[model samples]
Target: MQNIIEVKDLRKEFKSHSSRSGLKGAFRDLLTRNYKVIPAVNDISFTVTKGEMVGYIGENGAGKSTSIKMLTGILNPTSGSVIVNGMNPHKEREKFVRTIGVVFGQRSNLWWDIAVQESFRLLKKVYNVPDDVYKDHMNHVIESLDIAPLLDKPVRKLSLGQRMRCELAAALLHNPPLLFLDEPTIGLDVLVKLKIREFLKEMNKKYETTVLLTTHDLTDIEALCERVVMLDEGKIIYDGKLAKLRSNWGEGKQIEFQFADIHVKKETLDPLLADLDAAWTPGNQKNVWIANVRNDEHIISEVIGRVVASNKITDLKVHEISIEDIIRNIYEEGIING
Candidate 1:
């Protein structure tokens, strides 16, 4: 597949001023003028192929939004190059706008007082879409998103889920080949989220739309993205296939066991299970230990047997490590480990 978006050595920085505490300090600082340069995006580079769905993920303040802004031509990079569909985004912004669509979860693009269908018609005129093309695309999106019932509802009167469906329809009214989705499922209930995800999958298959999504929901990443790009402290910490990330960085399963009459002390068991790096915590009730095992299923069962021999065992439950937990661990441990 050919590359639709290419970002090279992108860098964006901001000069932040320091505030003084006391009146005297403030007066002196105003005269001296103290400021620090903060690098929000530092020499990061990546490519998105045509018709690929890529997940852009990171913790807060990790520069995800800044990078998206640069890609969408909303903000110019301090240094480096961005080419979207064979055009320089910053230099040919007018052409770029007609080629891509963007939706921000924190904001709305539709007219607040207008009906859902009214907003779509207005966008058709604004984008200068041909009447036949607009009708064809609108019918497809309306049926796919199941927003036919919502066409007459005012934007303010519709629920968040309804409004989001309308927003997606409005963004695609121009028939852009590329789409940028920023937390599209934010604040939506599970049922509504599932509906949105299904609609997006249909769109991808039908239009071959190349989508770049930024979301905190792991479920969204798991369901929609084939590859994930993780950023930390303004740099790419992990990139590649999602399965590879899980195999390499995803720790392992967590096993929790309960005993009827457990009386063993931590000092005694700690040395016994020295080979396995496990943390034991007492459960909410009595005679139970919740153990977190790291990539050693055999050792977990062995330890359980040993515990059973010494104490009366009741029940055991094992759970696979979730992607959310794996990413959280990566952030807590920092990007590199010795």
Candidate 2:
């Protein structure tokens, strides 16, 4: 596969000025100003191949937005290199933007006063899409996003969820091969998120669109991306398959056991799993027990066997450590390996 996005030691810096409160200090500051250089995106490098759905994630103020701006040609980097689709995003912004679509969760790309379909039509003309191509893309987007009814409604008149659906449709209407989504599913309900995720999956498969998704929602990353690039303090920390990340940092399993509507106290099960070293807790409902079991100390089967033999377990569930947990651990431990 060809590399659609390539970044190497790409760095971006911003200057800040400090002002004093007092009159003398303020007057002195005006004559000799103080400025500081802050690196929003400092020496980060990664690549996205054609059709690859990769997650670029980090905490707030971790440079995710700054990097996206640079990639989208909204901001120029202070140093190093960024070649996206065989063009410098900053220098060749006019041509580069036509090949990609961007969606920012907090911002509106569509005209607020215009109807949803009008916004899309404007986009088609802006991108100079052909009549047949625009019709096909619009049909697919409206169906996939379930926004056929929203087409006649003005953007300001729609609800957040409805507007989001329209936002996604407008971005994909031109069928840009590269998509940059910054928290596309933010503040959306579960059903709405599911719809968006499914639409993105189908779009990627049908069009081979390379996606670079950045979001604080780990579930979005888990649902759509097999590979993830974790960012922290403006640098790449972990870039690998999600499975491998789990193998390395997915230390424990969460096992839940539900009793058969009987009086099952914690003391009864303590004897059974005394040696399992499980940090057990009671579920919200009664007759249910949840525990985190270590893989290094005991085999999962043995642990389950110990509990099942003594207690009547009507239902049991075992889940591997989730990406959310793994990410929390990585950030806390400050694991830096790319």
Candidate 3:
């Protein structure tokens, strides 16, 4: 497996100035300059192999977007190197961009007044894609995304979901082998989101396109990526399989057990529950009690035994921590440091 993207000690810094408060401060600012250097990406390094989909995730102000910008040649790194498709992205920006596609959910790359199909045609010219290749990609994407009916409508006239579908097709018109998707499904309905996810999955499988996806929606990551790179405060904290990240950092499973006796009292059950170390909550049902327990097998068994010994268990459920909760915990704990 060849690495489609390679980043080594990548760093990006920005200089921002503090605005003068009042007339006196403004006069002082005019006399001199005040600036502060902020490191948006702090010596991060990672790799993505061909045919691999990686989820890049972090809280706001984290360096996920900055890293993607450097990798896609939109921004030059203040230090270190970024290689995509065997080319230095910042050095050979035009050539590097030719080998990859990018879609930022907050912005549109499509021509506002032009029809969706025309925007794709213009992109084909921009990328110098051959007629046959362009046609094939267009046909595949249009059909896969079910955007044929939207082709004739002006980009600005389409709804967000409709326009997003067009934006995705436009990005792929050149059939770039690598894709940078930053919140691609953001602000879309559940149905539309599912459609986009399905199309992306099919495209990756059929074309072997390597994708780097950054999204706040954990469901998208769970569906699209097996590997994830977690960042915090401009540093990579975890870079490995999503499952392992969850298994390692994941808090634990929550167990909910329902008892046969609907009128069971907490006072009576206090003796049986006193031995377990788990937190207890009264379930919505009168006889049910929920226990938040660790992921460990022995601890879970002990908790379950205590619950069962107190009363006849009718229904039970064990739920692992969701990816959303996992990421939230990571942020709240300040687990990643530069």
Candidate 4:
């Protein structure tokens, strides 16, 4: 496979000012300024080859967006290098951007007052796409995204889901070789997310477009990516195949504990399985809690025994631990730092 992205020792830092409380501190600030250098991306490095969909995920304030900004030539790193499609992202920005498509979830690239079709036309001209090529790709994307009805509507008039479909169409107008998606399905409904995921899969298959996706939603990664790069506090903690991560988690069983009290604290349940290879997190419902416990008869019984003794358990259900559960555990516990 050809390498589309090459990042080596990529680091980005920002200067933060220190503030103080009272009049004494205000007077201190008049004479000398205090600055703290914070590293947003601290000596992290990774690469993506052509046609690969890789997920870059982490918690909030984990530098996922910061890294994306640097990769897209929007921000210059304090040190190190970034090369995309054989061009420096920062130094060769004008040329480099031509080979890549970017879709930020909260931001729109389309002109708000113009019709979606007009934005597509403008993009075609901006990227210098041939007329025939533009028409063919435009028809293909509009049909694939089911956005034909939205073509005549202004961008601001479209709903979040409708605008998202248009946003996707806009990004692929020029059919760039590489795509960067940041939370592409962030605030959309489940059906819309499914539609976007299917479209991404088809586009990847149809065009062999390399994608670097950064999302908090693990389901997106589970559905679209075979490999993932996990980050924490601007550092690369785990980088490898998602299947391998699940395999190493062993045969664990997920037990959902439903209680009468919605105000139950996790700290009360964690200590029961402290000595075992287990993790607990809040379930979809407030009164329900889920735990991934090792698949040992004795271990499972010990956990249930301890918990049942303390609380009035309304219901208990056991099932196979899912990939989402393992990834969520990593989010809370940092279990796969190696």
Best TM-score among the predictions, by candidate number: 1
Ranking by lDDT: 4, 2, 3, 1
- Looking at model 3, which ten-residue stretch has the lowest summed lDDT? 329-338
* Pairs in steric clash, model 3: none
Q: How many backbone clashes does candidate 1 have?
A: 0
TM-score, every prediction: 0.89, 0.86, 0.85, 0.87
Compared with the true structure, all predictions reach lDDT values of 0.85, 0.89, 0.87, 0.89
| Candidate 1, residue 87: how far the Cα is off, in Å | 2.2
How far out, in Å, is residue 282 in model 1? 7.7
Instruction: Residues 263-311, candidate 2: write the lDDT tens digits.
Output: 8888777777677667677876798888777875456788788878877
Clash number for candidate 2: 0
Per-residue accuracy of model 1 over 1-338 as CA lDDT, tens digit each: 88999999999999999887899988999789778999999999999998899999998999999999999998899999999988888889988898998889888989999888888888888899999998888898899888999999889998988888888888888978899999999999998889888878888898898999999998999999989999888899887888877887676766666777667566655665677777775666666666767777687787777666766668887777778878887888785421
Selected candidate, larger TM-score, 2 vs 3: 2
What lDDT score goes with residue 36 in model 1? 92
Model 2 TM-score on a 0 to 1 scale? 0.86
Q: Regarding TM-score, does 3 or 4 come out ahead?
A: 4
